[model samples]
Target: MSGKQDCKTRYPLLLAHGLGVTEHGGLYVPWGRVPDVLRAHGAEVCFGGQDAWGSIETGAAQLAEAVRKIRHLYGCERVNIIAHSKGGLEARHLISAMGYGKYVASLTMLSTPNRGSRVAELLLHARPGVAVWARGNDAWWRQGGDKHPDALRAGEQLTPAYLEIFNRTHPDACCVYYQSWGARLGKHNTDAAMRLTHGLFYPAHGDSDGLVTPQSARWGRYRGTLTGVSHQQLVDAQGVDSGGFDVRGFYVRLVQELVQMGF
Candidate 1:
């Protein structure tokens, strides 16, 4: 029941991670146990090894290579990509600008800020001192990612000013189908960290998944929001152990939709 073959898409699945996360180590997994769960459900899964905090162009290039590798290994023409957070931007970049559309069957984004989030815009303008934390985080972000410690710059890129330019330049691929999923913590605080982000993002952006509001996250075939699920709980496998939302089951349903779409 937990690991049923509910997501056997025609193409294999590629799981992409978000910002400030590196696809490494048991403890450092991006999609966490979702990979294992998908594999258990008879779907082949690969990880997109893009940098956590690199420029979109840079990260997408890395994703291009990862897609190539997946194609070679599976001996398949394309793979279905499920990306989270900034990885969704990288996925779009690959398909739209980097000549990767032909190698991607479908793109499913979870909690991606497609229209850009005001949270990132405000963070950069406020110029709060995240330097000390970023220094440590950048170490992992730079691992096979980008060179500079670019936390603040990454925030700038996630603003509408930048994404508007990005949408124009990297318009959707005619051959690829796009869809998205999003979530939100209950209005009442559940997780302290997510609560802080909810207060910050909701006022400016309306209901949000802690960091991204529904307005910014909506793209292509928008799936309805997952109530009571925070941005962190959206992807963190540890949440399953903590009696949180059924992360594994949620993905089972998401990927099953792709299977139904013939991807």
Candidate 2:
């Protein structure tokens, strides 16, 4: 119950990042200082280490491997996954379709598009050169150490139509605790980089965190929304903040709650 041991969960915490992101480069990869903060609070933290841009199936395979490594390294049976964006989908796949439910203690998703995103639908059909662009991105990421980056299929899988079938095929694992949190940008200018995405995604989906809408982010226990937080700020990316939200403190409390739940 002390501050030093506030986030000491029974199992190690695995932080999973979303599409077009990796936790292997720079000073701050995906979760920028989040893992450090968790560790400071007596929690063991690791990364999913999935491809920067890959299909959910491939990402889930990588996550399963990551889980295996983490379990062996820590000599623990299960891990508490805290995934963001597309990483949440991959975690779900790993838990259900991949039959790794017993290895996962809980899943807490941040801004995941569990019900699919309208932005993906628009990107898939709105532009004629979308496929071409995806192919280019795949090639680039492959050179960056991705063995099977499938940008086209990755984007396709995020569409509502595809996920409707995906949901049927991949139901939630009964053994794992699942919860999700949505983020809401107070305005388009909440994060300058998110302005364009906010402009495009807001028209049809209503309240959103620049990319995923609140409706699409709803899944599992639905842990409410983070007001004035952009998608980037959700992970403390680029050291940006919205409405003075304490990004690190938010995660500290999140992990503390998980510990309190005896995860």
Candidate 3:
């Protein structure tokens, strides 16, 4: 049930990154480490232009545009999406709101905040300093609309309003299967920076992935939880030197699954 075969050969993968990150097509985590593995197995990767820290809608639009460009470049009609964190939300919106499902094959989300993050909520109210910092970033302003109030409002609730819209439009798009995975920090040693950030932004969901809770990361349907993997660890924990669980095997397994599923 995949889309046109030509598209698969031209743009085999569309890798979308989470917020506060660059979209210059560099490898990040799991993608950084595993993408090559997939390529070795005959996969072509592309970038889904991501916002530095934009709203879900804005990011989704950028992703859709990227997909369109990929399609045009490759002369294919469909592509697969591999998104991380908030990137997952953007990918979902592309399929639903932007009518990209017709051109998509599969969507694989890793450690995404699908149900909204208590951390983001807390930051909306507690951290005036961070908000000011976020304002200076072009990506943030693009996604948040150049106003703290708007950003706060948009992130206030993972409201039924947003969820209902996405569910209605994307509830199983043709030939596009939605899948997700989440991880936890377990201990402060996983990432001292993340530990400090989590303490400040989301003290409630202790042992979370700095920005999102394990529960919020579970989107669409239950796949399986990767125990002991941190938010960043889910990508590539090779020899780069980082704390938390060893996710090398996890990345291998996930890429293997995507290949087996014909992503």
Candidate 4:
């Protein structure tokens, strides 16, 4: 908490994981490797906490609290946010809705669904029972019902409501950066099944990181894309492509970019 305080020095890195999942889930995936690698490279990594099934607003509030705590503990006003999946949406909420942009230096999302997913709609309809169960257990459920007018209005369209708020609030703050990556299953394995399930629920455009597609992941300005990395592989330290590419290194690079940005 008391390391680098200079504005030019590396800033503490806050990692936000996507919805219906925990930080450990990210850690369990290939993308999770980013935190360890970033820490090895002198990044102060913190995970955003909120119920895995929580709404974007709820997750953003949690992230806002985490940011305040990070700033209080580190004595740094600005921190870099490296979010994956729903975590990206939560980070955007923190900056745009919770007013954490004042404390945010940069934001990088990994396989986030900035655009609405047809798969999500299908799941909402196809698996009403699952949706009810998820909603019941989800933190967002505590706030309001799934059919709540606000909830209905927020993510009604392709961009979703929370994402629109994020775009309006953050609107490319100084030194703010955005980038994304995607993955697909090559064979019918456990990982591939997971990707298929995610696809069924998220229904992204073209290629995806299993759940969210590269196109769905776009928000703010575009940076570029990384192909052949599955959603789970993106954070898994043990995950390796047949081509021998280090999937975790991709996230590490993203973290490094945030650190270089003074966040």
Candidate 5:
């Protein structure tokens, strides 16, 4: 009964990935094997093919187009967006600012920095040399899928000050049901790269899943955090041994929750 193909909801589901993660040629999905599992359980899943390093506005516009495609292709009225990290920001913007609330039934954000990231504040407050290095990094992102990959801009948006201001202008849509999920990777985390980040975020944010902290990700309905899942591990399987949270089972429960809620 749990993993059966009766997990269908009233609307189709769309998966949106975080920054620096692009879906090229539809060969690779951001959520790894999660999409196929959801489909097997009777969920019609789609992708929001936005640029990896695009600005929030750019991401929102791209999401609007993707939503339109989903509606037309599947003959559905609305979509339920499952966005991760920065994609959550874009998905929220689509519902709030781009008038896409009517087209969206719900938004389930997994590990999104809704309140903003602690490192983003550091980068913004750092010396001019760091800013220059960021520009060089932005150039690489620009070459990928970002027509305008301004790290400074992306950084600014992820800061507390900017998020506070952004929230005022782009409040949650009345028609859309919003909920968020967060994760944590402490100092003793398995992911080596995340362990370093965990140390950096210790003084400011305490516990984070490599990039975003638990406090920063608490937004909207505030779903609980994934105990062992890191930011990278949530989207990628990482070779053959991702030992934390069951990604496939997580989505099944999520969709099942939606189905129970009449979404």
Candidate 6:
């Protein structure tokens, strides 16, 4: 039964990546082997295909299109979304603000800054050169295939103040089921790649996955945090298990639960 097709859902699953990433390129997958594993378990997996640095609104627009395309291609009425980090915000915007609520069966978010990120606020409010830095990011991403990337605006939208307004404006749709998961680094040295971010995020927020805190990551159902995992590790960016946390298996179980839920 372990090798059986057990993770299939009523609606297809769409994997939405976080900020500063493409879904997959070459042998690299921001979601690691999760997509393939889900497919192997009888799940029809798809990608949100949003821009790496686009604002939530723009990302939502892209997701809206992706949902429509997926619905048409798969001949399904709705999809179950598994969004990471900022992608969660985009998914929320699509379902609530973009009038795609009826098209989404459920939303499962990972390490999303639902309330907002103090780290983002700290970075954005750093200096007068923030605008220049944002422009530089946009330029780089544009060169990398993002048509109208707005790094500054996108970063602003991640701040607590902006998210406060955002949460008020984009309330959860009654038609959609929403759930979220967070991650944590355990200690400052849990993941060397996340060391700096963990250092920066830990003082202000108690438990975090380098970038997003547990509090900020909680929204809707609030499934709790994945202990001993970094923001990157949560998405399997490094593609290896860490401290007993099997990122791939975690996603498999997640989808399996979705299956049980009749999504």
Query: Which residues of candidate 3, in runs, are more than 4 Å off?
Result: 1-11, 24-31, 127-131, 139-170, 201-203, 237-249
lDDT of 5 at 2: 40
**Predictions: Cα RMSD each:** 2.9, 2.2, 5.7, 5.5, 2.9, 2.1
Model 6 residue 45 CA deviation (Å) reads 0.5
Query: What does candidate 2's lDDT look like per residue over 91-150, in tens digits?
Result: 999999989999999999999998898888888884569878988888888998887989
User: Model 6 segments beyond 4 Å from truth?
Assistant: 1-3, 25-29, 188-190
Model 3: per-residue Cα lDDT over 1-263, one tens digit each: 12322222333688888765554322233345555555555557788766555577877878888888888888887887878887888788888777788898888888887766766655555557755654555454555442222344345434334555555656566668788877666644456556677777555655577667777777665576665555666655333435545444454455566666666
Q: Native-vs-model 5 lDDT? A: 0.80
TM-score of each: 0.88, 0.95, 0.76, 0.75, 0.90, 0.95
List clashing residue pairs in candidate 2: none
Ranked by lDDT, top first: 2, 6, 5, 1, 3, 4
State in Å the error of residue 164, model 6.
0.6
lDDT per residue as tens, model 6, 1-263: 34558888999999888888887542135898777788888888899888888999889999998999999999999999999999999999998888899999999999899889888898887757989888888888898888679988888899999999999999999989999888888853357757777786668756678888888999999888788888888888887887889988998899889988889
Residues 80-192, model 1: lDDT tens digits: 98998888998999998888998888998888988898878877665657555566667765665555546666777899889898888988888899988887777553567
Full-model lDDT for every candidate: 0.78, 0.87, 0.64, 0.60, 0.80, 0.86
Worst 10 residues of 3 by lDDT: 1-10
Which candidate should be chosen as best, given lDDT against the real structure?
Answer: 2
**Candidate 6 accuracy as lDDT:** 0.86
Q: Model 1 has how many clashing residue pairs?
A: 0
